[model samples]
Target: MHPSRRAVLAGTGLLPLALPLLGQAVTPVRAEPAALLRRAIPSSGETLPAIGIGTSRRYEVAPTPEAIAPLREAVLRFVALGGSVIDTAPSYGTAEDVLGLILAEPGLREKLFLCSKVGTPGREAGLAEIERSFKRMNTAMIDLVAVHNLIDTAMNLATLRDLKAGKRIRYVGVTVWRDSQFADLEAVMRRETLDFVQVNYALDDRVAAQRILPLAAERGIAVMVNVPFGRDRLLKAVQGRDLPPWTAEFDCASWPQFFLKYVLAHPAVTCPIPGMAKVAYVEDNLGAARGRMPDAALRARMETYVDAL
Candidate 1:
């Protein structure tokens, strides 16, 4: 793992959450279909589900057969619960392979709106990586392809534009998770005609809202949110703090829902991708996509609650 990725996971104290639990059949939670928000790609008007699955650490480390079984079930549960967008990358070791295996199951391929990233810094290398991703994903065409972290982003975006025009990829976008790259990301968002932009934004991490999100809304670019729980740091912050009762107003049944709904409520955010390996966690995360989202006034109260904590 990259040191930065390790640091991101370590900062969130995810090891405990990742501990293996006895596999139990997860009962699907009955959540009414929340109001679905739709956004159009600037170049193409294709609409996408507003909540996506981030399969970074979540799918990268299942070394044992026992460990992989639950993930297969989790993927099924995710689709059953109305999840369609799944984000993965070549850099996420073994995640693309594992997702490929699960997706090969009968009726699984057509159920997903797949998104993957090219981590290589050069145009040729990035295109080669995306080709490998196509083979690993067991799909002829992918739904979305992004330049991961904007490494050689301009070159990669140019390549993506060509591929998108040829119908090899449905949407083209870019992602930046680190705070240091915000300025560059803003420049790209302003100058590039993109289908989407993946960003790090959560209730506690509102910096993106100050600029990136607004630009995306103005540019008619769909937004895919990564690290919605602040890479799990926000979960740690709320560990001891009981969820406020007013959270129930939006049918937020857990802290995950509370945090996720806050991000999903943003009109600019088309989706919030949270990574999880467990079937129960998958069901829980999908619940955030259902039910009433906090309106502006209620969103303020949520921020205040988190701030007070």
Candidate 2:
């Protein structure tokens, strides 16, 4: 029961608003339907916005003033929309350097709940990379440090544990995106003492719901979802399709909202980090954070609807 384009246009009354006056900056209208929703991290009971930004390939840009301005705006606007967590890594080309320049703004740095990872193999290499992240991101103490893709899991987790003990980072965790890695990922979640785990989940990919997500809930590990859009595959699937009217029950206004609300409905999900490179995308994604989330039955309906597409 998707709304027709004309019906949506008529309901929103977008045709009546006048253009901005000259010399007056148009403030982006955000959906303040309610306060931005938050979920607690299981280990420390710290809470974060239900939706966060993932700067993977998106934030990797030439570290020039002009080149980095849009990214800077995205970061600033993300905070303005009540976002806190931002996930990045050294593996993304020039991403740390560009983000470093943006976060050099003292206000912006303080506003973010920053998380980065150690990707190299040995403890020495991991330590060197960790120090480099500290330098590149211009932060003395990071909010979280994870073993990217479970690389050198034991060695890197040991280093993260030491750093956490030393108070260089507030939390320690791990991340992986492939379903093939879920067994190994689940093993670590079971055997190790971790504070968080980032895995792939979206309306299009529900593999995490089977075991990884449930195990995280059982083990008291915070879950950060990556690939919430299925790397744009889901968007392409619904390209010309309108969102179902029942999505409004969860306060969803767009396909992205429909997708994100589905992921967040799982009690184990702390945040879903969808990579956004533009201010408009940030606004849309942040809007998803403010609205009501789907209930179990609604989530099942959403899954069935998407499966049919």
Query: Which portions of model 2 miss their true places by more than 4 Å?
Result: 1-33
lDDT tens readout by residue for model 2, 209-273: 99999999999999999999998899899998878778778878788778887888888899999
Residue 276 lDDT, candidate 2, scale 0-100: 88
As for candidate 2, its clashing pairs are none
- Cα TM-score per model: 0.85, 0.90
Report the number of the highest-TM-score candidate: 2
Compared with the true structure, model 2 gives a TM-score of 0.90
Question: In each prediction, how many residue pairs overlap at the backbone (N, C-alpha, C within less than 3 A)?
Answer: 1, 0
